[model samples]
Target chain A: MVIERASVTANELIAEGIFQMNVSAPKIAGENPSPGQFINISVIDSWFHPLRRPMSIAGREGESLKIIYKIFGAGTRLLSEFPVGSFIDLLGPLGNTFELTEGATPVLVGGGVGLAPILWFDETLRSNGIDHTTIIGARHSGEHFLEHCPKEGFILTTDDGTVGIKGTVLPTIESICLEMENPKLFACGPEPMLKAVKQFAEKETVLCELSVESYMGCATGICQGCAIEHKSSSISEHSYHERFSLVCLDGPIYNAKDIRFP
Target chain B: MSCNLTVEIAGVSFKNPIFVASGTFGYGLETQELTDSSSLGAVITKSITRHPREGNPPPRIVETPSGMINSIGLANMGVERYIDTVIPRIDEIGTAVITNIAGFSIDDYLYVMEKLEACKAPICGYEINISCPNVEAGRMEFAVDPELTGRLTESLREVTKKLLIIKLSPNVTGIASIALAAEQAGADAVSAINTVFGMSIDTQSRSPYVQTNVGGLSGPAVRPVGIACVYKISRKVNIPIIGIGGITSANDAVEYILAGASVVQVGTANYKNADTARSMIDELELYLAENGIENLSELTGGVIPNE
Candidate 1:
């Protein structure tokens, strides 16, 4: 609740234009922002605009929290430009957490900036001693940076034929499906990718949890800025299509079956 | 010691004066775990309409100097769905539930208000939104024209006996004249200064920063402007003024009340800190008690004129 201005103790360019920064927020890290939960990092020093940039918790090192971000626009670009010691205001441990399934084989899928969530997922599964398989995909080889991929079954794919596989990660997933036993797919990526995975994956046998992105005002549930429709059976029973849920409140994570995407 | 902070708006009293703004608070249900809803005066629901809205495209929000720009498109479930799913859960909180209604037309407003009237929750009042920018018609038309403002208020007055508060836009040229029109039209109160229309551009890309090209700006940058508007309108109208805009602290709320706001709404502040309004109200009560003030009304319009 206390929005603090923490300093960036270290900044590393993990990939070209992609930076991973550790911020000094012992209190925040101690509180433990859950996987799939995000933090709002202030874009600039002044209070000209009230909203904060929502970023996923990459991993938490001792006495600090890690945020992996790519320089996309003014906010991210400005964020990347912050010197190591500059103070950055943050509002965090926000939104709902990814519901961890007990004794389930976790398959983590990430694409581009969406990779941030999976990183936390990997750390969480590792800590819990849950076996997880991470499949990461990028546009090409230049963008494929999976060095931080935890010691689990790692699958890499690129859109261009420059990496492990030539086609999409979905194809790689299908191939893996033939070899691996019943695995729960946890995916966060572009909508098309998630949709493709959702369409192909076995819905009943495989529990799929997805992280979605939307235009938001308050990263918190207020504002109704980030809402996703939830299909209801009662509406179908009544011969009406009724659904309701908010991404900021209900989840940035949802069972793949529950989401009715835009 | 317990922090006793309570304030009243209209005839409905609040446990505290820190109520979340209409669009920012969504329904109280969304933030159940983040903050205690019962601790505040009221939770204003997201702006509801006769029909559901998908809202604007990507990049709906952009960060400004000390504030942020948002074009959230006032997305929400239709009134019927809201009453069924959202309202029933509100009573558990004990805090007053204020519903915000928006429409594409006067008829749409009347329909939504009628639906809200049917809800069982303690609908203390209605905040009629006539200034949301993301919508194509309806809201901006009523807000920009004084005559249209009067008509909308008059229609709302006829349909629902519940106290009506008209939220005015700050984007217009003559906000005072519009506020005067609302008073003439029988509005119970007026909440001012929605987001100011603005945009930020990415120099390198030669494109608008937000996907929506332009959005409404809120935060500290707009606080002074909000205070100025509240002061001007409070002087012009007899109705109690509910000040909103860039209020983030107890001093900001105090400044608005001193400028003539009977109550204040915390919007963008909630985004920055979920407990902002409650903390602000606590701070305000402490300031009042320390100064030996008993009632908040004593500080309303307390500003001294320059000699």
Candidate 2:
């Protein structure tokens, strides 16, 4: 991984509390970071906030990287206030990337800022002339960003009846999988939501890939702080201890069958 | 005149005095690409146990005011895998390497130590980790009691002729007594202090932030505690002191040296910047030169008191 000063190219509020930040980081971009990989951004220069914040790559262009984040705490609040031309120390292209298998139609599922990686994955598939479906869920219309995505094969859902379907993303995922042949699932979101998706895919015996999230101390695998439990029956290559996988090194992207919610 | 950063601990020479604390730098391979880890005086590998441990359940870590609380529960790949996967590549680090051993019992520690002794890796010494607070097996019992600390140190000292350093915890009532016990029991040096026991609660959920409810705290918040422990232990023991706890800058390292620490380790700050310890090497030398000091060892226990 490389640490570089990535200057803010743009930071725009796409939804109520969500923002899409663009930075010019040739050093990180030169490594050819893929979808599902993340960059740990150093927040304010203070002792209180010592650890860097890990943000997934939402998109990438020539030498620019895009990150979508919601202001959940003091760190993100400060990140939102960075004016254009300001530089942020970034350490990346970290963790494993999403695996796209041949003959399997990709079905991307996301919610909130978790949609960042999914959006990038959708763009990647489209650019490759590959066929895929995108499903997004949010709390309300004010929390959704449909305009930023392609109109075709992109579905949006809301918890309240302010958008496409008045429910969670599970029903749409089920319906889409029932009709498609060789459907492989790709998902990312808050822990509870990802757990739900994991369970749904496992009951149906469908192949699924999930981008997990955790409170990381060192996004470089030194601290061993981010622990994701291993599924007892599943064989894993990265489970050195035989029971846990560190999200920073083993994955942010994992085959759902290899991991279990703990 | 030039400043010398090299330090000799128990007859083992280090290129500098900036060592990356155990459990913070992993096997010294995690951040090789981000920083020149070879620039460090030494690297202490994570605590290796007899059997591979899965560690504790999440959320394992949470950030507090100026520090963070962590209950990793000594999660590691066990001693066998460490030797199989890490030891052969250990020389790539290009610095003095000290292996940190943690176990639930004296036998467990000896078992791992004996195995390492047979491997013939370029390890200069062993840092006995009897201070990890997150695990239940040992409950860090050896760190709190001087007699227990002495017994553990004495047992491990008989196994190897290499340098032996006892890592002390600040969560005890008499930390100096424990350090003295290790020194009397044949420990070559002592490192103080490990993390301070701490906890945090979330008001909204009315629950602890970390799953373990309590964890070991390390960061800028614990720097004073570390310095105090080092000063106290230095007064009690004649052996060299390795100061650890939230050390981030050369200025901080100097403070530890003044308090009687022969060397310092960068802990939580490594998370903020992996290159922290490597950068401090030059900064520390510059510090000595600017002050007209020729040797860093002279600064150890150099704190002046008011008349």
Candidate 3:
């Protein structure tokens, strides 16, 4: 992990309230970051915005990395206002990455801003000459981020019927799971969608890895702020401290079987 | 202009007067890759208990306007594992290490102290944590009650000749008396003002943001409260005062020194920038040089009030 002062090369809105920012972060980008790792960004160095917002790396090319974020709070709103050529402090590429199995049919699912890591994973698989299925979900057609996604082998779904499929990504995921052998699910999204995916993966006995999201402090595991509950009472092999899995250290990526959601 | 940043706390001399507060810099090894830890005067490890604790459930922390509330609940690897894993590697850090010990009972604290004292890891001292508000066992009772604080310090004081510093909380009516009690009972120093009790609500859910309902608040928002506590405690205790709470830069550290702290620990600021405390050593030297002060200690309680 490293702290780099990355300059914003581009920041553009791709969908409703969603933005894609490209930064010139040689230090972090040079680390060969895998999917599911993230960069903690500090927009303003003031008490008003004390903690850095953790944004997953959507894509990376040489010395440049891409981050997709939604303008949900003051921290992100300030991030959206940073003009090109401005500098932002980055602490990353932190957290563990998604594990890809050799010969396992990959099924990638993403919802809302959680699509960042999935898109990166999709591109990684494609580059490796691996065939995979991709699903992107948003509330409606206007909220979908398709510009950054590949044109082929992608399924677009929206809650409303204004998009390709008028439902969540679960149905498409189920169909892919049924058709493929040794299918491995890689997913990121809201809690509800993840829980649904977890249930489906467990019933079908498919391997599943999830990229989690949480409000973090120190992103380096010093603060012990970002915590998620694990399934086991005894410490799992993945846990560093105890029962709660630190999202920053042990994961921002976890196997769905190891974590429990309410 | 030359200045000395060295400070002597309880007979242990530190290269500089800046130390990373406990709990903020986990074990001091977690950030070695991101920042240089050896340059720090001292590294205070997170509070270690007699047994391993799982801590509270998820949603353990939340950011406020200019601060954050954390209810980590003292989740630690226990004293035995800490000594086994972290102590043997202490020399690698190339700086003094002070293990912060926390427990539910007097024996619990003594157990940790004895274990640490018997070790040969060159630990600087012990920072007795009696101010954790997240746990239900004591609920910071030792910090609020002077008698309990005196007893806890006196018991641990008997077990070791090393530096004994009692961490104090700000959620009390008489913080000075607590510091005085620890001093009278043989505490070598007192680190004033752990997090102030605070809470934040999520409007959409209309409930507490942290799972523990209320946690300790630390950041720039609590700097004045910490400075006031240090000043009040400095008046009653003869031992050195180590100030901690929301210190980000040399200016904030200087404020604590002027208010009566012999040294300052970077707390919430470490979360934002782990290098803040280490960098403050240079900044502090520059501060003393520019102000025509030859020694950094000369600024302790230097604040002048208009009568």
Candidate 4:
């Protein structure tokens, strides 16, 4: 999993602060980055911090892969300024791939910027021809990616009723689950939202998977920088694994049951 | 035909000189699915102490202007458990496995080395890490003072017959003196230029970026300083120098080798690029081949006199 130096083929200002950059790397794009798998984009020339920001692959368009991101900090600001044709290093297709259960209807839930991973997952589910529904939520209507959703079976929610339903995506999911029996949930969002969804679902009936976020270094699972603590009863005699699991290696994606969300 | 890039540091001969730094490499076994460990010069395991450490709390790392600040707190599986679990698995890799030992006391250092020496695995060498700042004691403090560095190096030297390479702290005032002291204390080699102490502050929180207040800085921000330390230490000591800091490209590595480093380790670069070490090896070979240099040994301090 070498970090290949990728050149930005196109940088388009998609919306207000958000910019979509397409990088030219067929080998990495062809690596078949599944849903929930992220590419760590090196922000600036030499500045390492904000360490490498993990950007979910927005969509694959030919040889170039798209990353839709907002300018949050110095790292993202630098990333936004990456002139077209400039080289940016990328450590990819890193982290565990999202599990695809056979013949299971996936209810993709994404909130705010967390919607990044769900877009890829939606594409995956569509390709597999698995019946799926998406519940996308944002703080307000302006932040919604309603246009990006697949043509069929999509639900939209916003904090304010300027556009979709006037609540979080959880309410929409709750309503959907009540109507649909035994729907598999695949979610990536803020911890509170994911935890709420996990608690709402019947453990046996609904197999839920969630992608957790953490600060990372050595995105290739070398540095234990991005580790999440898992509650396990069985303690190993060795000193390594009494508590935490690395987010970079063990998973960016884990069985919703395995994680003890904070 | 190009020659194989092999070098000897602290009496341990590596098939190449591009070993991963302690913390950045994790345990060699973790990367088996991603990389070919056998192709590396050596896989230096994360710093192991006498007991298992849980490491620091959240926000262990933050990115700086051109580097990253890390306060990892030297998290490891303790020496005994590492030998029991990690060493056995590493032996299967067949390449040189260097155990990086970090301790809070002289006894802790000795105990770890004694345990590692007893392992059935072909323990290539012991990289004595006296540079970890996150630890409250027995780390950067030992290397800050030349006499303390010498005493600690001597104590560990007495217990382990295996090759001893003291990893020197760059945070110290006189890095060359520390390197010289380690060499005088019977250390087989000295690894110069560990992380420089630095911190980033969060504007919103109005406090330090890392919970541990201060952290070690590594990346391109520290390359010039690393190269300077290697050049200065290489001039002061005859023992081989394993230069490490912000080596990202082959040119960065070449600069260190020409600065008199016999070998170099890629640390922060590995975080940016997983195949940094192998790519560096390839780039170095290409540089040598292009320059008509026959052997890597010829490049050690190969920098021509500026005059």
TM-score of candidate 1's A chain against the true A chain:
0.89
Interface RMSD of each: 4.9, 2.3, 2.6, 2.8
Which residue runs of candidate 3 sit more than 4 Å off their true CA positions?
Answer: A147-151, A233-240, B132-140
What is the iRMSD of the candidate numbered 2?
Answer: 2.3
Q: What is model 1's native contact fraction?
A: 0.49
Residue A240 of model 2 has an lDDT of 53
Cα TM-score per model: 0.76, 0.96, 0.97, 0.84
The DockQ scores of all candidates, in the order shown, are 0.33, 0.60, 0.62, 0.41
Task: Encode model 4's per-residue lDDT on B1-307: one tens digit a residue.
Answer: 6855789765567888788888877777766655677778887778989888767665677777778888877767787778788776876665888888887777878888887776645777789888643244524478788887898899988887778889988887789999999999999998877899898888897989777899888888998999899889988999998888888878888898999888888887677655667677788888888988888888999878579
In candidate 2, how many Å is residue A13 off? 1.6
Order candidates by TM-score, high to low: 3, 2, 4, 1
Clashes of 4: 3
Model 2 C-alpha lDDT per residue in residues B23-101, reported as the tens digit of each score: 9998888788878888999999888888777788888999887899999988888899999999999878888889999
Q: Each model's fnat?
A: 0.49, 0.71, 0.70, 0.52
Model 1 misplaced regions, further than 4 Å: A1-49, A60-65, A71-113, A120-215, A227-262, B1-16, B57-59, B118-121, B132-140, B202-212, B289-294, B305-307
TM-score of 3: 0.97
Q: Choose the strongest candidate by DockQ.
A: 3
lDDT of 1 by residue, A67-148 (tens): 8889876678878888898888887766777776766677888988788889888877878777778888888887766743
lDDT of 4 by residue, A66-182 (tens): 787878877888888889989988878777877767766678898767777887788877887778898888777677646534357777787887667778888788877667766
Q: Under CAPRI classification, how is model 3 graded?
A: medium
Off by over 4 Å in 2: A148-151, A234-240, B132-140
